[model samples]
Target: MLSGAALSRFRKNLMGWFAEYQRDLPWRRTRDPYRVWLSEIMLQQTRVAAAIPYYERFLERFPGVEALARAPQEEVLRLWAGLGYYSRARNLAEAAQEIVAKHNGVFPSEPADALALPGIGAYTAAAILSIVYQKKLAVLDGNVARVIARLYAVRGDLRANGTWQKLQATAGHLLAGRSPGDWNQAMMELGATLCTPRSPQCLLCPVSEFCEARKQGLTDLIPVKRSKRSTVELTLASLVLLDPRGQTLLLAPPAPARKSAAANDVHTLVSRMWHFPSVAVLQGQAAEALRKFAEESLFRGRGFRLEFFALKKVRHAVTFRAITIFPFRARVAKLPRVSASKAFPLADLSTVAVSNLTRKVARAALALN
Candidate 1:
């Protein structure tokens, strides 16, 4: 708990640091609720540096809420190609349309209305209202959570009820009587820059004097995390089917059985893009896995004397599982008589939407060809 005098001094020092040191991000220049909402969505599960180019390009293409609302979801996903997390792109567009329908293309000023939108959650609603509308609501993103946790020496599982409640109280208490835009940005900026999760620069921190963790030498241990999910190993085998014209065969995903967080990850696997048959396989059965996948994917049914090439492995991480992917390439001498929908020429890959994971897989396999 911060005393009245201590909180005032802390906020003063933090905002001073932010005023001089905050990065001039493109989104920071505008108070447009649309842009703020877009940035917040993109920044979720994505790094700031990577999100910048996407943000700028998306804004150029979509321009505003009305523009985004008018654009097709395919174009939006194409513009969002290689960014992964395709649901965010889809949901962002849905939310824009909702805003247009509900608020005449303007973002809602009320937190409840914003939260009612398709992808806008509590944190995002708070951020949009606070940063753009200057509503005095505390933003409790991962960055702000870390800053608050360390400043007050919060410990235990951050997800635990008591710890989470304490952090919320600390954030609200610290946010009292401050400009929501400046204060929220200051807390986040401090966390992103100085008060980082690992090896925080205590001496350089603007509010180091007020940080309980720094004074107690517990900076590294202050924001203790709950036990991590155990890392599981998964081996995935994909059969790459190619035509005589050097076009790669791609297919749309089958409908998933149900919707869950894990289902969302699978959505990222082949959302609106061309992809080969991908499936998890048991260990040490790479050959059998490829054969089964090839059979199921019409690679064998095409009757084109396919020759297989064992390309290099592509590895990717998702939550607890580290997937080691083995891609096998097969070529058909003659093209199939029937035309396909989503297949594209390998050379013209740039013209089509491709997931970042697919790009990574292609980089490893295409080099072999």
Candidate 2:
């Protein structure tokens, strides 16, 4: 609980240091709520370096809220294909439409109003409103949380809700009222560059004199790490059926079956996107499992002999699920007309909205040829 002269000195040191050393991010160049909101959303689980290109390209394609709202969902997903966490792109467009319809294209200034948007949460609402509208709010993201924990020598599970709330209070208390935007950015910059999680450069920190963890020689020990969820390993088998005209077959995930279907029937990796016909398979039986799946579902009524070649295996992950994909390709005179399946030009797959896992599958199958 820093206060009085000590708090004033801490604020001065942090702001002065920030003025001399903050990174020149493109988002910092403007106070536009839309751009700031977009950057905040994109930065949510992505690294800064990986997010910059996507941010620039997304802004170029849909320059403003109205443009994003007007664009088709598929097109937005296509442009955001490689960036992953596709729900963010979807919600961004939905929230834009919401702004246009409800607020007449102006970003909501009120904290509650901002939080009412599709993907905006407490931290997001606070960050966007503070940085763009100069609202007196503090951001307590992972980096900022780490800095706060180390500053006060906070110990225990920092991920715990009670611990987190205390850190948020500390952050709000330390916020520089007059320069809320710069103050928030300065705090984030300090955590990201100097107060890093591992091997923090305490000696170079602008506020080292005020850090309680440094004073107690606990800089490296404070801020206990959060436990990770256990990974679930899975095996997936996919079929890439291509016709002589260079079109590849894709299928919508099958509807959940009742208990009547074979016990071996597999589940699709992703839903709501077109993907190669695939199924989860038992270890060491990928080929046999896919053959059975294709014969029963893909060629049930149609009379076509199945001849397939195995392609390279692809490894992918979604959240805690670690997957190893066994891809098989078959050349046919023409693709079968299966229900819930469609054919797209293989060369133009980029135009379609598909998961990164699907993209990896396509790349693996293509690379071998």
Candidate 3:
């Protein structure tokens, strides 16, 4: 509830500090709405360091909204392969199509219009509008929320909608009219670098004088979150089918069991992309089941002399399961007709969206070939 000159002074001090010490990130170098939108989407559940390379690769492949809209869905998914949350990639493609059709291929300038785009919510819309367009809007992402909660010593479950609304209101009131972009960036920077979740460096904070948590010795406890749901485990068995010609096999994920009237559908992992034929295996049987399944499902039906090659393991965390993927490679006597696709080269391993585990197997198989 800062007001009058106090809010102005707070913003001035924060922005001044930001000018001196903001991190040099790739996204900060451009004001292009397309680039901002891409970075924001890629960073939804990913860290900055990981998102940077993906962002660069995506931009290089599809440089603009029109290019993204015209690109094949498979290509888009391939660019977004390792980055999980496949729905984000789908939404990104849909949004690009919308921008091209409805907005003449130009990104919407207003925050509300940006929010209307697929996969964009209030925080993303606000960020794009403020940072790219320099609009006088407050952006309250997780980082900003934590920073604001700690600064004002707001004590409640931040996950609660009421608590979030109150914090957003406070943030809106604090934004300086002249420098909304800098104010937003400063708040996010402070949260990310200084007001970290554990052992916050409050002593080095720019506006320590205005932080209630700093004054009251509650820097570590003000921004509280409810405990998350327990993670559920799942086991997957992935197959790498190789022919005598050294070509591998891939399958597209099946369509939804049912489609809504509006055509909105829920998609599974690796949806709309090229992936190795895989099955969910029972825990502890991943190794054996994969070998047997590959022999029966692939080789016996096609009459190929299958030789079990190397087995490579990959550990990745999905929403719940700490997935331990065991990739088993087998070389067959001949290539199956189902293994051919115009979109991907079964002979070339680099063109498909294989899981990280499968990628490891493919690389090993290539080296051995």
Model 3 clashing residue pairs (backbone): none
Model 3: lDDT of residue 82? 80
Candidate 3 lands at a TM-score of 0.87
**Which model, 1 or 3, shows the larger TM-score?**
1
User: Candidate 2, 148: how far from true, in Å?
Assistant: 0.3
Q: Would you give me the overall lDDT of model 3? A: 0.74
Judged by TM-score, which candidate is best? 2
lDDT of 1 by residue, 1-369 (tens): 777787788888888888999999999999998999999899888889999999999999989999999987768878898787787888998889998998988899998898898888878887889998889888888888888888778777776878776777778788846578788888888889888878998889998888788889889897885678788776777766677778776665434343534532434445545566666677788768677656655645655355678788888776566777788877766444332346667655666667766676667667886
The C-alpha RMSD of each candidate to the native structure, in angstroms, is 2.5, 3.3, 3.8
Question: After superposition, which runs of candidate 2 have C-alpha atoms over 4 Å from their true positions?
Answer: 252-268
> What TM-score fits each model?
0.91, 0.93, 0.87
Instruction: Point out the higher-scoring one by TM-score: 2 or 3.
Output: 2
The window of 10 residues in a row where model 2 has the poorest summed lDDT is 258-267
**Candidate 1 structure lDDT:** 0.77
Q: Which stretches of candidate 3 lie over 4 Å from their true place?
A: 255-272, 287-310, 339-348, 361-369
Q: What is the C-alpha lDDT of each candidate?
A: 0.77, 0.85, 0.74
